[model samples]
Target: MPIGLAPTVRSKFEHHKIDEAALDGAPMFDLPFNPGVQIRGYSAINQPNCQIIIEDFMPGTEFDWTFVHDEMQYCISGEMEVEVSLPPLYMETTKAHITPGTVFSYPVGARKHVKVIGDAPFRHLCFCPPSPDYPFPTLEQLKGS
Candidate 1:
């Protein structure tokens, strides 16, 4: 299946091919706030109030992000070191080392710095649920942010 292809219809449900080869042709973009960092990904699921994305970050990529809505992420390959700020007052911070099979979540307004480490590209799946207002920012939209 080609990357960016609409979800396949499967008798009242949707299906998407998320293998790395399926996304090899997907376009890559630079994060506006992070120099020397590039990301390539495809949204496999786009529902009225939920979305699922498969993304790859080359080693050496680093950036800070703030969640627009609640999100969950599962690492599929490689590694990342993330520094997260505690909620409420957000006065304290913690670090997590993510590897394949790791699962983590971020609440709305959660902030973190992510660094792709190791020799290979870091791959992950990101899911946003319960609200459709928080589509991942596109390059154009991110440029002004």
Candidate 2:
């Protein structure tokens, strides 16, 4: 088969949707920059060039974050508004409401403020290019840079 003129072939790889049971017991990470927001997740793939993680964010909390590397997130459930500031001056911020099935990407050095809304947990699958021990930089660290 050809996809846009590129040769392709089907493989025997099996794919399955992440179920409710798989979301349980994710290890939580402490966010010193934003307290009271429950951030828990586990990494399914952490390799040299790629990293995949399933993260759950509890509702009714907002936090500021800056990625040290490039990342893309696919929302599986819940809702949130992410306001990403343009770098350099950061005089303006663009906001987007992310819902289930929405895929959002963040370039390295982009700063975003995430506000988890609604009553349920906001769950998303995150993909990154670099396998950093912790991908997000602290607010103070962002300032020091």
Among these predicted structures, which one has the highest TM-score? 1
TM-score, model 1 to reference: 0.77
- lDDT per residue for candidate 2 within 30-125, as digits (tens), equals 766776666866655556666677778888878998878889999999999999986667777788999999999988878999889999889998
lDDT string, candidate 1, 3-111, tens digits: 9899853423567666576555556787656776788876677775667888888898889887778999999999999999867888888899999999999988888
Clashes of 1: 0
Instruction: Tell me the lDDT of model 2 at 90.
Output: 73
Q: Which ten residues in a row have the lowest lDDT in candidate 1?
A: 134-143
lDDT of 2: 0.74
